[model samples]
Target: MTTEQDSRASDAVQLAETTTQPSSVVARTSTWSVWALFCLSVGALALTALRGTQWIVSDILIVDGLTAVMWVVVTFFSGIVHSYSRRYMAGDRDIERFYARVFGFTLVVMTMTAANHVALLAAAWLAMGLLMAGLIGHVRDWEQAQAAATLARRYFLASSALLAGSLSLLAWATGTTSISGILAQADEISTSVALVAVSAIVLAALIQSALFPFHNWLLSSMTAPTPASALMHAGFVNAGGILLTRFAPVVTLEVAVMSAVVLIGAVSALLGQAMGLVQPNVKRKLGSSTIAQMGFMIMQCGLGFFAAAIAHLILHGFYKAYLFLSAGASVEQTVPKDAKSTDTGVSSVAIGAVTAVGAGVVFATLTGKSLLAFDSGTILVLVVVLTTLTATRDILRRAVLPATLRVAAVPIVVLSAITGYALLYNAISTALSGVPMTDAPTELTAAHFLALALFVVAYLATEFGWHRSSTRLYVFLLNRSQPDSSTVLTTKAEYNDV
Candidate 1:
């Protein structure tokens, strides 16, 4: 009887262990499959770059500068996120499904980037939305994930339809289905056709980029796994900027469209930054930051700085990806500590302003332009200069450095960074000159000035209010930025029950 009981117990243990073997095998297979796909994508991108050949596959797919660069970004991020997910999601039962969805989304985005034909672009756009829906809802058992996925799917589908309409209009106007051909012949297209097409494109981009009111989907998407969040924020959100840059000629033709883009983008940027500051949750804060960055990128496109927008897109993509991957460690590292604060008085701001002005003057001189020109390029230079000065001022004020060295170091570092950025921007602009973008609108209207003034006023007010410790504004922003507690509790309960 004892021997019989022992054999029965062993058999039960084996049955329990073997039950999970199939899932383990499936997960391993999916991981290797994604690895292989990533390797092939990188090899192809490298080969295309080395050959400097625009490969046209049956007049539908074209591998050129834009496609090659974006392909490299997609593949690199996809590989990194996939590898990270393996460890981040180690114990999940749906690991295989998650990997499959990620790979599918990556492939769709790659195809979209390489598409040269209108039909192919539309198909890839639709496929991306569908695949992303699956990825967002990877945890199908959770109500929050399902709801977020549904919301995302709705917005994506709407944006996809608008993009399709824009492409159709462009093709109809240009009398060709080829993207490159349409862009090359943009000057020949009638202003009416260009206006309609460009408006559609801009509106579509606004939705896709998550400009305010339409940004809830992105915030809700935090219910997804870290890898998905990283991929979505870093890879998918930039699609709007890419679209605008690719069609710069058409979009920049109408001053109204450009003004609208700038105004909308400015509002989104301000609101996003404000919300980010108020969010208590780390991931939600990051999401808000992504929204702000995307707005800034789209605003660059509106300014006829397509090359700069592309640079920003790539840099922000990599930066956000790294942040998401390392967020867990960052939260722990940022734990509050007691440290003595120093009063730098108003000197830091004054110094920063001087440094910014000096850098801007130097940049303008280097580019053979006057500060009064105030063109798109000049604006970009000023932005870079101001950013550099801000960094320098923060360091000098916060760090315990010798006064003389601090004063000397700020100028050196600020000058060097500004020079480097200006040179890089010039090189990229020259390289992309083949892309037909008009010079910035030399004439500014009342509306344009109003938009700029609103941005400045909003920023100043926020800063002043924050510094003054205005309880009303702080409470209002804090309440508005976070989701309702009851909803969060419900989602948590559903997740745990699942």
Candidate 2:
């Protein structure tokens, strides 16, 4: 009788498992994600080596600090999202094609970021435009799919013209397309003419980065799945920043240029925060953050914060990638199968917490700096640190803590000591970054205070206690999945079978 019951239980559990078929879309996406990661890793190491030596490795075209770093960022995140897609995708279709396109797009953008020559850069831009279109339209069933396609076509049309114009200008101004070669002779170009020509070209690059004043393509791209969204944010959304960095050697800075950079950066940062604060959708909030952070990064470059900007770009890519793809696991839950990807207003506390912490870090950093000066340039290091914090927060929230602390346990003494040191570190860091006696008083600090207060307000808005309806935001929607009740039961039964 015992043996029969055990056999019957085993069949039922296996039946349950087999009954469910993982989404084909997820499987394909997962496979592609992994492949992109692998190939991008190779690209990163190769670019690093080439830049380190400043040598011509023909097949490997990466040549400068700014472009080389973007390439690496793209690849690094490609790997992360791919890794995440494996579990998240589980079972999906078109696996091979998904990776092929992702990797191909990544390679194009990576190469474009580092392309020293106008021709190569143009090629990369065109390819990126195509990739963007494909990513947005990947979900064929959505009504927005056609709109995404139209957006990509528009992007391609503008990018192509921009590429042609920029190339013509480069040839007219510098007499050569090679990056290092032009940089060497950049100063020889007439200052006024060069500024106008290069600005036009760089403006075209902005389409790729989704920088403000040219950000429609990004909003239209929300139809894509989570993995694709990750690629967009961390992999290539900062292409304009990369472009600025590479061309910095040649792009002559005048009063106009400086104003453009600083104002744009500050505006992007503030705009992102404002939009993000009010955003009803999770992915949309993240997308806005990307724009804001990227804005800060480019602004830093304008501010002449080279090292800091690169650090920010690298870290932001990884963290954004993780956040996006990790978010894939929840996409199915967030959307109704009936369609219309509506925001059920799930107050993602974790996301809000991370964002709050990020706001705090930025506030602290700005307090340390002097942005109020009349001739102040971009706040470079702070911008870079901003993205790094975002990435680190995601990694810690997803990969680090849950695996170690939540599912597992820590010794009492070790836990208490960590708490003590963390508090001490924060206190000191805060004191150091806060306003000095000599510094002018401004409202940025007050903004920080308001942000902290808002954090509390956002949490209270969840209103989980009010009610539960069909349209209600699902509890545990923002949180990651745990062992399903059936999985737990099945495992226990299997143990008894053993």
Alpha-carbon lDDT, every model: 0.74, 0.55
Question: Distance (Å) between predicted and true CA of 106, model 1?
Answer: 1.1
Model 2: which ten-residue window has the lowest total lDDT? 434-443
Model 1 is weakest, by summed lDDT over 10 consecutive residues, at 483-492
- Give lDDT tens digits, candidate 1, residues 73-189: 787888888777766776677877887788878888889888989999988988887777778778877776777788888989998899899999989888999998888888888
User: How far in Å is the alpha carbon of 90 misplaced in model 2?
Assistant: 5.3
Q: State every prediction's TM-score relative to the real structure.
A: 0.84, 0.61
Per-residue lDDT over 1-498 for candidate 2, one digit per residue giving the tens place of the 0 to 100 score: 699999999998876564353445544564565566556655754655444444345633644334444544566666665655554444345454555667677678767766756677777788887876776676554445656667656876686687668667767787776766666676687877677767775676566677766665675566666777888888677666566655665543444564466566666665555456446566767877787778766655555443334555666777787677666455554444562322212323344344434443444444344444422321332333343334333333344334334222222322333344334333322322211111112222232333334333423432332212322332322111111122122355545542
TM-score of 1: 0.84
Deviation in Å, model 2, residue 163 alpha carbon: 3.4
